[model samples]
Target: MSEKDQRIQTGKFGEDAACDYLIEADYKIVERNWRCRSGEIDIIADDAGRLVFIEVRTRKTGGRFGTAAESVDRRKQQQVRDTAQVYLRSIGCSAESIRFDVIAITMSRQMDSILEYKHYEGAF
Candidate 1:
């Protein structure tokens, strides 16, 4: 597989893991990979009646590049917020409680196992 393909595969694995984790934590998975002209949301779930927009970042190796959570900078956060707003407008949800979350998955390059999983609520 090409480098891009490998990256995509790793991302898919991460997302699957995140979904399982969220479900175990009592979050209802409303949607996955919701996209628009603004951007894409990795996951959209309901956490105890609060709407959560989640971003998943996966990295097999983290060193000089930084942890997966740290990769979500201000610009990316803005993109997520923009996309979330578009989603809310489309659904006509004005009074919903919302939160931004980041799920960072780190994989072991050699063993291909998860090394770390961190979920940050209201990261932005």
Candidate 2:
């Protein structure tokens, strides 16, 4: 596969792994790849009755770019907020108890082992 294809495949696998990790951690997944004109949310879940919007970032290595969470900059945060608004409107969910989360997955050199997964709740 091409480099881009490999990256995409790795991303999908990472997201799936993140979802599984969330489920195991007691989060109820509500949506995956929820998109709007503004942007996209990788995962939507319920955490103890609160609405949780998750942004999953997967990286082959973190040394060069710093870390996966570093990728979600101001512009990306705005897009996530906009998409969350759309999601709230569609599901009639109140923004009061809603939270934004970031799931950063780092892979090892072999690309087969997960080096780390950092979950930052109430990120935005």
Candidate number with greatest TM-score: 1
lDDT (Cα, tens digit) per residue for candidate 2, span 55-124: 9999887457678889989999989999999999998877999999999999986688998999999898
Model 1, 2-121: lDDT tens digits are 989888998999999999999999999999999999999999999999999999999986556889998999999999999999999989996359999999999998626999999999
| Predicted model with the maximum lDDT | 1
The whole-model lDDT of each prediction reads 0.93, 0.90
Model 1 per-residue lDDT at 21:
99
Pairs in steric clash, model 1: none
Clash list (residue pairs), candidate 2: none
Q: How many Å off is the CA of 37 in candidate 1?
A: 0.3
